[model samples]
Target: MPFTIDNTILLFSLLLFIGVFTTKFSARFGLPSLVFFIAVGMVLSKFIYYDNAALTQLFGIMALIVILFEGGLQTKWRNVREVMVPSLSLATLGVVLTTLVIGVSAKFILDVSWLEGMLFGAIVGSTDAAAVFAVLGNKNIKQRLTSTLEVESGTNDPMAVFLTVSFIQLIQSPNANIFTLILSFFWQMGLGLALGLLLGKIAVWCINKINLDSSGLYPVLAMAFAIFTYSSTSLLKGSGLLAVYMMALWVGNSDLTFRHSIFRFNEGFAWMMQILMFILLGLLVFPAELVQITWQGIALSVLLMFVARPIGVFISTMLMKFTAKEKALISWAGLRGAVPIVLATYPLLAGMENGHLFFNVVFFVVLSSALIQGATISPLAHALGLSQGKKSVVPHTLELVSMGKTNHEIVEVHVDEHSGADGKELRQLKMPQDSLVNAIIREQKMITPRGNTRLQAGDTLYVLARKGQNEEIKALFHQQVTEQDSANV
Candidate 1:
């Protein structure tokens, strides 16, 4: 068949369908589904010979915006806040340390120039959230450890991007001073954070005020807002990725109409984004080129997986008070993914010598990380005593909300020991009309509370109530004991 638009569409559809199927199959075998997605893309690229490299790159960029935004939305302030200092320090200083260590090691081991070594280090320094989240989700692990990893993955991208671009520019202009580089780094990250906050707030205000009849369209609008935030921030010489991610995190945790539906949509969207990013990255590779560089690539991948990562983790987490097991697990969990490959593209785009070699090397590193690190994550977690016991099977909760409707209600209720509802069946609580307990978190265990489930003291209940009735519901639940009732008692 001729390579036309129709043919391209059919090919993409087939790949996507097969990709989903392969992901399911991979999961059944206890392998990382992402590896399968990339494998599928590689197979297809060899067979079909798709020629739209530019389009693939564009799609990869778009996918990043979605992935980062979804990540942001899913992030909770409470979880991040608890580990803010350490997480931030790791993302910023730890990334710098990792890059320097790897760069210096690469210079000595691989005989590359300092700038080239730094580029290699920067490209591989940041952990990929897509890989980390996919592995960590639904796994039994301590909340603090999981949160620390999640927060690190989500926040560390900008630093990697900064270092990568900085080295790229330094290589291009060998005379650039250290002071100029430091100032530029500060400016980019600072501006990105500011723009993200501003844009996120505006988006939230717009979402709350706009009256849209179709609830399904709200997610699309939110996505547009996210993309716009990213683009505007990038245009202003800021880290658009950071801005969009921070904005999404803020908005996701905020009080917005159709909040549940938006989150649900974004979750699926993010997964799709991850799949597409990996596939595009896979397609960007030339199998012939990879074969030629295989040995060197393998060596660097090994150095990164074993030497660079462990040393960086050890030094960074030293004196941080994490248990020995926790520290070991943290060291093992630095799985690389699409970010390095994407960052590698910067050098290629800059027409730098050895750019293709760098890309292939980074690709091999990611593949190895996914294979070794991803495959053994659960086992390592278990060995390190970080695994949560056998998982409990709980039915998932589906939350649907109407958008642009101020009549909807969001309520928070804290369970107390003396409350009459404690230890009583959910059905017996006589909760206000049109109210449902969406989530009940007790001792850090998240439960989808059912009608027959008994409420426990110290549980945090997220109750979704009907609009205009929240005040009445709160009054009913928070009723004080009357003097007459005491006298009768």
Candidate 2:
């Protein structure tokens, strides 16, 4: 077949399908699905014409926005509430610290100038939410640990982006004052925070009130709102990525119509974005350049995964009560994905020092991080004894799409013979503040639940929880804690 435009489409279709299937066996080899995507891009780079930096940068940004928004949507707020300070600190201060350590290390190891090294460090600093989320979707973790990792990855991007852009500007204008840059940092983050919260609330309010006739339209509406959040915040000199993520988080947690459908749609959307992004990024590179940076790239990758990430996590959680084992797992969970490669384009676009080399190095570092860190998360979690094994999610779920804007979820949970739920009265389950057992099904018969009613071993629970309380509601039907619940991730 002649490699025409039609052939190109067929090629991509085949690769993407193959890529999706390949992830099924990714854990066996201890490699993330992203490595294959990049490898595919490198293999095809010789056959394709993908030398447009500007276009690649544009698409990468778009993909990242969607990816982060999807990260927000999948996250459950209630799970993270208790660990808010640790999560936020890791996202903000932890990112800055990691960037600095990596920048200095890269400068000396790579023999690069300070600005160039800082730019490289900043680009690769934040843990990629796409990688973490994709990996953890298959992971069996405790709820708090899962929430902490998700929130850190989701929120840290703005800081990394800020540092990347700031370093680029410094290189361009050698006379720029350090104090001014510091001020700009705070200004951008502050405005982004305020606007993100405001826009999130506004979007949620509008989404709940404007009951659309078609359920599918709700996802479309939510996507449009996400785009608006990003664009508007960026135009106002704030962190658009942060704003978009915050907005999605609020919408996901709110009493919006068609909430379940939107979540499912966005999850699939996130995977597609990851595919497009890694493939495009792969096409942008020359495989030969990667060889030049191999040893150096591997060294930097090791520093990032083992030294910088652990130090950042430890410092960020200093005031908290985390076990040493949990901290170790958190450190290992830092998987770098396409975000660094995407940020690599910033230096290239800015015509900064060793821009091409930086891009290639960042690319290799990401591949290393994903291959080394991504693959090891499960094993490390197990070895550390921090792996809580999987929680009991409501199997055979049947969610009722917002009969109309209400902040409640209809969840169906099975109470197996081993579950703690077997003999507990409704009030003794200690469900979240507003959650209730609306009904029960036992022996193929439905029964309306009352507060004093006792549950049975074979009962199926019909629960109504306030929105974003999926974690809280699941606890009611979970089996009693046992020592041997091995993690499957």
Candidate 3:
């Protein structure tokens, strides 16, 4: 049947339903959800004639903005700060090294020009934030390892973006000034950082000061500013993606109203964007085209996984305190996702003659990376004795709603066997003066706390406490209590 607005909506909704449903199988099989979502797009490609590259590009950018912004929101400033130096080195120098190595390899394998080969390298250089975040979900991985990977993935995109755009310009005009390009990269990144900080401060102030009748509108206000930050930054010749992530990092770490609600809303929203991004990318290509470059794609993928990425990690972390195994895992964990496929579209849109080849090859590399690296990261971590094991599943959750600025937060504390408060009555525990046990959850059941109710191992406590009392309250609940410690409290 011919397309109509009603039928379009019907078809789109059906596709989304299938995409969301695919998550179950993804979890069951221990595969990245991107695999299923992209497969759905490819299968649908046979029945649906959606080959609009421009539309895919537009949607991809919007999706990345939301995804990165949500990433920033979830990241803790202290965690990022601790690993800042090494992560930056990986994001910048690692990307450049990876690009050069892969570029040189592709030059020989594909018989392409140095610049063209490097362009392909630049396209796939950065480890994707979406893929990294998804694979590392709630894993009991060591904090240092997790923080390094997360920070690196979040910060590396701008470098890849710069390289891709610059190489495209050079490919078009071989005589373009190298110094001018270098200056441009610094300007874009510098302005992006400044704008992100400025807009983040403005956004937090607005969210706290503006009292909307409906609580829901606060998130809407935040969403609006997020989009504006990206577009406005790009319009001024800055790196919009970096700006979006930076703005979110600041907002997420700052004290503000509806902070928890804002995070919850964006988390769901970001998932939606991820689904759409992969599917759209999947729809943009023909599987038959991928077959033509199977050998070449696999060659580049192997080179990237075995040689390029490893070299990048080793050289980048050579001075850092990471162990041999940690660096090795970091190398293997550099899985590609939507960002690469999104970046591949740049060559096509920029009028590169072999753009389709670039896109198909990048698509193949991502699929292989996700399947190979994504599937094995957990087991490898376990094998290396770096896995912290999975965190406990807490069925019930609590959030504090704030209509204005407040110092109160609902913090979750787990009572393990080692905790001194595990067998003590609620009234006997010496919590901070302003803190209160709001509720307790055990075995998925919520229980109202009474003065005489005893805490048990495996219980989850929702404690409402002042902002600065987190360490004290957590220690009271989780640490071993001695006679002197109790007396001091």
Question: Worst ten-residue run, lDDT, model 2?
Answer: 480-489
**C-alpha lDDT of residue 52 in model 2:** 83
Tens-place lDDT per residue, model 2, 1-489, is 687999879987887796687676775786788887788788879888687888988988888888888888767677768778888899887887888899999999889898778888899989888888888877777667888988888888889898998889888889989898888878888887788778889877877788787778877888888888888889988888888878877776665666667777887887877887888899999988888889998899889988988888999898888888888888888788877888898888887658898898899889888887787888888887767665444343335665455666776777765676677788777687877778899899998898888988778887777666765566544534231133211
> Across residues 146-188, which tens digit of lDDT does each residue of candidate 1 receive?
8788888877889999899889889999998989888878888
RMSD of each: 6.2, 5.2, 2.8
Best by TM-score: 3
Backbone clash tally (model 3) = 0
Q: Each model's TM-score, in the order given?
A: 0.85, 0.85, 0.94
lDDT of 3 at 219: 77
Which model scores highest in lDDT? 3
Instruction: State each candidate's clash count.
Output: 2, 0, 0
Decide which is better by lDDT, 1 or 2.
2
Models ranked on lDDT: 3, 2, 1
Question: What's the true lDDT of residue 59 in model 3?
Answer: 93
Q: Can you tell me which runs of candidate 2 are displaced by over 4 Å?
A: 1-5, 394-409, 414-418, 422-489
Task: Please give the range of 10 consecutive residues that has the lowest summed lDDT in model 3.
Answer: 394-403
